[model samples]
Target: MSELVEIREDAPGGPAARALFDEYIELVRERLSLPADFEPPEHIFASADVFTGDGAAWLVIFDAAGEPIGCGGLRVLEPALGEIKRMFVSARARRGGHGRRLLRELERRAAAAGMERVRLLTTVVLHEACVLYATEGYREIDRIQPPAGPPEIWLEKPLYS
Candidate 1:
């Protein structure tokens, strides 16, 4: 299964990226029970220039037939620190080990960019994503209760330790 997949570094604004990101956003919105027109703040959603410029990268995972199935990004928060942003795998691609593979690739990308530790924020509604992070060695550090909606979970993992 792993052998049939390929992870490639790419721009986050491409067609494949657009499709994957749209699917990901919709899934999160539905799980959180938000209205169709709801728009999360930029900080909570897309951070500007995150997958561009220095110390940041976006990746898309492709299946054997060359269709994008999963995507993720690494954005530097500070010196030697990066955040895992927009990690997602499509519904049809779940449980195929693609998420884990995509995450590992992102970690490699982070290390190459000189990051030592990585952090990510996820909503409690995303059970599968939370489980994937835990299984990938990300430990929960904080649970933040927003004024509304489910609590957001913050997790951290060190690339070197």
Candidate 2:
């Protein structure tokens, strides 16, 4: 069955927001085959705070019944560049275009906020995510080696192009 998905902007610290983020982390850890005791880096967790500031936005996608099924955030990294962070759709919500919808919405909001480009990073293990980003016009730029955690593939897309 097709479910109606609605994206709503919200504070990253809300209870529902925290729950969705926690779920996203667990899914990523499992998909990447991380150790059972692996913990996400502090910087990654702290980055959520930036979404609560100016030129930034946090979005939660809700199902028709008002249940959150996905979440993402856009943060202005520089004068005209924004970054997509913490983007995820629940397992049950996959392959239904919800992810693409969330991504497009984020990009629209970014453009409306005067952003000229958007960048994001994901691990090589997230094959589906990598493919989605690539198919959506994001080009791989470089590999980022975080202080702690697996290396990440960086991708960027021009908003106006």
Q: In candidate 1, how many Å is residue 94 off?
A: 0.7
Go through the candidates in order and give each one's C-alpha lDDT: 0.86, 0.83
Q: Candidate 2 residues 1-161, lDDT tens each? A: 27787889977888768878778778777877777676667545446678866779999989998888888889888979999988888887888888889999999989988899999988887777888898999998999887655788889999973
Tens digits of per-residue lDDT for model 1, 1-161: 54488889877888888888778879878888788887677767675368886888889998889988999888888979999888889998889889998888888888888889999999889999989899889998999999999999999999963
RMSD of each: 1.6, 2.2
lDDT agreement of model 2 with the native: 0.83
In angstroms, the error of model 1 at 86 is 0.6
- Number of the top candidate by TM-score? 1
